[model samples]
Target: MQTEKYRGYTLWGHAILQQEGIPQPAKFAGSGTVTRDTKVVEVSGVLDAFDSDEEAELVGLSWCRAWVDSHG
Candidate 1:
């Protein structure tokens, strides 16, 4: 697990295992938006390891959950 700090939030990287080829790393980028001193984190980024956009979206959601746990 690797961590990148972004806009008061941390972006984590996880390497997806591959069976026959090189595995690409999934990047989770997030930022905190403030409204009346309340921190609302918006996690959005791409998962380059995915073969398709749909898969990327799925991976993004997983990253979102992880991001929320880490930042919330």
Candidate 2:
């Protein structure tokens, strides 16, 4: 997992590998958890297709940024 510490939130990204039940190919998944003294809010979802592990991690970071901007 890749983690980024921002001003008011902590973002994490992980590469999803091919799983048994998941039909789609591997992709980047991201989650953001608020770090401030607000109510606990966590958001997670798939970001995009995975080209490489490093690329997937970057995609996840980007997704985390968007999520935090909208939902933080």
Candidate 3:
């Protein structure tokens, strides 16, 4: 899992479909600057294990989605 804190908000991410040890390149758009309260973290890698029924980027997207849902 990865945690990115921004201001007073904390963004926590988890690799639900991580198959490998290294995470794939993901494009993340967030507001604010990178500081003690704001940062980006890559949790895990994408591998063939997720080729069966899981999506690679969906894990991160889901976390973002949930964050939006909760905030909005």
Candidate 4:
């Protein structure tokens, strides 16, 4: 997981591992959370999958930023 502050809101980007113990390389799914103060504002569904944890987390962060901008 990764964290960032955006416009007074706390955003969390998570990379959930998938396809563990397989012949192929592991995959990660992107998800996000948005919070204001100590309250939860939003929790995202699986946004997409990526080749790396960093890429997945980046996607989650982007989703969080867009949600905050559009809803705030």
Against the true structure, whose lDDT is highest? 4
Best-to-worst lDDT order: 4, 2, 1, 3
RMSD of 2: 4.2
Q: With candidate 4 superimposed using the best TM-score fit, by how many Å does residue 15's alpha carbon deviate from the native?
A: 0.1
Which candidate should be chosen as best, given TM-score against the real structure?
A: 4
How accurate locally, in lDDT, is each candidate? 0.44, 0.62, 0.39, 0.94
Per model, state how many residue pairs clash.
Answer: 0, 0, 6, 0
Off by over 4 Å in 3: 18-72
- Model 3, span 15-57: residue lDDT tens: 4433344576433322211122345433223322334222433
Model 4, 1-72: lDDT tens per residue? 999999999999999999867798989999999999989999999999899999999899999999999998
- Which stretches of candidate 2 lie above 4 Å from their native place? 19-40
Candidate 3 residue pairs in clash (backbone atoms < 3 Å): 5-37, 5-38, 6-37, 22-45, 23-44, 23-45
CA lDDT, candidate 4, residue 69: 96
Cα error, residue 34 of model 4, in Å, equals: 0.3
Clashing pairs in model 1, backbone N/Cα/C closer than 3 A: none
Model 4 clash number: 0
- All predictions: root-mean-square deviation over Cα? 10.0, 4.2, 10.0, 1.2
Cα misplacement distance, residue 61 of candidate 1 (Å): 0.5
- What's the lDDT for residue 61 in model 1? 47
Q: Which ten residues in a row have the lowest lDDT in candidate 1?
A: 28-37
Off by over 4 Å in 4: none
